[model samples]
Target chain A: MSPFILICVFVVAFLLGYRIISNVPSLLHTPLMSGMNALSGVIVLGALTATTLAGSPLSVLLGAVGVALAITNVFGGFDVTHKMLRMIEGKNRQKRARPELLDA
Target chain B: MDATAYNSIAGILTLAVLYGLHLMSSVKTAVRGNLVCALAMSAGIMMTMYKDHAFASPVLCTAIAVGMVFGLFLSNTVKMIQMPQLVAFLHGLGGGTAAFVGLVILLDIGVANAFERVSACLALAAGMITIAGSFVAAGKLHQLLPQKPLILPGHGILANAILAVMGAAFVMHAFALDTLALFAVFLLFTAGLAFGIVFTMRVGGADMPITISLLNSLGGTSSAIAGFAVGDPLLIAIGGIIGSSGFMLTRIMCRAMNRKLVSILLGESSVALGAQDPAASVSSAPIAPKPADGENKAASWLTCAGKVIIVPGYGMALAQAQHRIKQLADMLKGRGASVSYAIHPVAGRMPGHMNVLLAEASVEYEQLLEMDAANPLFAEADLVLVVGANDVVNPAAMEAKDTPIYGMPILRVDEAKRVIICNYDDKPGYAGVENSLYRRDGVILIQGDAASVLERLIAML
Candidate 1:
């Protein structure tokens, strides 16, 4: 793709993203951040491609480390976000199921 | 896959991600939104692997497995309170990946286009800044580094010099000037690292939200710029989305704290620390004498309050008082008092931090109200129970001009009928501004550990 096209994609995506994310309540800001943090790991595509194209051992090793770190970022971010959401959901269910418990 | 087919699929997936964010605006559909985004991400990854023909690589697969394990272990082990630092650390790793990719691309002799070279330089600098800055932020949040802002001598001048050198190096390397590309890369790397560390080192706890949010933006921008270097449209688009999201949050946090993002980036301390040393004030002035019937008055107000608002802060987290707070709220509800928690936008270490902490304690999500929603209700509230909070509820933010927290939006706790403060001490908060609510006629100041104070209140009820 040409640089012009890439810049277009970036501008369109950023503006659209800003509009969508602005509506997310402060109640979920932490999860929203962690979720976006995971999405930033989309750079793994570049890392994987770099590893595939690397000719030397040092370059390949560095590329593989990039892959590992990116994957860690992706998985760690999503899993933690899932756990946090679950904490809220689980408590919501508990509150529903045991109304009397809270009263006591 | 053909380029058209690949790009088409990528576009659809990007829309799906945005739709997922739309769903995140509401609590009920948020989990499903997360799942949708995760699924889209998984599909995007598979598509990339197929496009790159990387599925068969043993080294790549092994790296993926190791990373998956490490990520799972971290997610499982981290406590709720540690979420901010963990997110910062994860951001660092993501930025590190971008830096490595940019470095590889820059070092490759085959690439000669000026646009690609400039993009690679940007990717490398942004990535380095994100990684180094994020790690410092995480260290401070994790208490590995000192929480106080450490101003290096002539920090502003040093940061500006580094930035100027980096900009010159980027220009030189981009146009393939006489300077060796490798030397230029080294210069950019060093400058990026220095600038990143310099800024984050001067960010204390009160400034954590801004720092973390800014790093989050840099992390995304780095990856997006790397995508431009590598000619990956999907990576650029997704990076842009994440970058914008982080910037939006950063702007919100800055507005909430009444801070200028540029001043924060420049490491300008809001108040002149030496002129208004809170420690000096503490020794010079005695705390206001508690009303002789303070405990009885607080107890009576608590029992009689038909409506109550609980304002919590970083000190609440410090005391690990969320559970006790939940218990206190429950006791109040048992007595037929309607209770809600007022959450300031910058209340904790990160945005929405208090909500997560409260959720962990099983406080009903409905009971947690954002600042704007809870402000008007404070006046109707018969009692305001401040548990370890100071700055957010300090009336001085509105009345005290020229102070660090001046013009900051604070919870209207002082506007309530009767206020009962359960803070660590009568001293100033992280902002170093005295809380005017402490001296108000109807307010009861109980200085002690938050959890024990909540325990005492619970027992009295």
Candidate 2:
């Protein structure tokens, strides 16, 4: 395909993906975010690939910066998600110890 | 194929593989899985640089590795209550990263290309806002900042004036008057950040989850704009998805509270608790607990119990006891008692909070029942196990006019034959008001960690 055609395809695919992913019900969002956040490792790869293929220095720099930022986001998002999950687990444990005290 | 092309393809494939593995792992620990994925992606990026200038790639890769290691260590070390604040910090980091990417693109391309310029500007603004806003949220969650609403005088008018100034600056910047416009942009951005923090601070704890969700959406949108500036399709797609989902979640939360999104944004409806005297005119029918004079002891009670209902809350989320709760539920079922989860819509700190926690524990979705479905069955339940829940089970929402939570729908767990409340203390819920259900004769306040309590309860059974 021509370069123009490839760009069009990229735009179209992104728009379609955005539309489909955007409408996910609130019930499914946290899970999906947890799932997709892990998946964001893809952004790093994309940035690296784009940087490597670039003919110009500006493009290369932009790509490198993008890679760096995307990596941070991936790590940060995962860290936060894990912490949130642990909180949920701790709360559950507290609930189980309720009945024995009444007996005591 | 050219060397560069070959390297690029390899990097992409490696990333895809890592993401797939991360998704497939049922390790149950979200952070551990995410670390593995991030590591793999970083490695792929390093490999691409191996063919040419290898110095920077290795350095970047090593940094990424170090971050992952530190994150993993922190995750294990931090207490559960501190996790949400840490999560908010991470979100701020993500927002900052996206902003950095946008800034880099702008610096590289200059303001020559209108498309890139616009996208970069928006990305920077959104990123800065997200960073500041997340910090504010984290501070509130951690109690570093007060939970009380921070309503500045004339907040609405000030916010509008700041926005208008920002718009004017953008217009001036577009016309090549960069100096004055830059100052205006800086002022506007600062104003916007301050506005977000103050506006959200005024919101009550009951409304925090919605604010967090909205902030998450703002972060996503900023990332998407950054993606556009950098010409990255994946970033745009992922960011847009996150942004839209966050928006929808915020809308749903607002609807649950019988409040409109505009009202929440304007801070008009979230006033201080009214001091109206509670109406005491309801039928004075005392719904007393069944006489505990029967011969069955606590041990025999479980064995003979035909049905059990578990009510979960924010405390359960804080303790991360969903899996243990499910385990106890399973144990109860094995002993011939049917077990089901009673999910209150506004249980915990957010809407659907209990459901989210339970799902994380790998509990069967079918076993969870909504308030409407579970209420009628409570009367028939031999044991009503409340796991770290309070406000949702408080009878005052329906009966007390003076209560802040009046008119809010709650689970009718008080109607159950035996109601066991699992919590740390008799402290009032997020609303700071006492739960009248604590005084109910049928209600039993079981004080301990939810998981340990359930474990002990199961052992006794």
Expressed as tens digits, the lDDT of each residue in B368-429 for candidate 2 is 78677888999899978787777678787788776666776788887888777767566666
Interface RMSD of each: 1.1, 6.5
Top candidate on lDDT is 1
Model 2 docking grade:
incorrect
lDDT at position B312, candidate 1: 91
Quick one: RMSD of model 1?
Answer: 2.8
Candidate 1 residue-wise lDDT at B307: 93
Task: Output DockQ, candidate 1.
Answer: 0.78
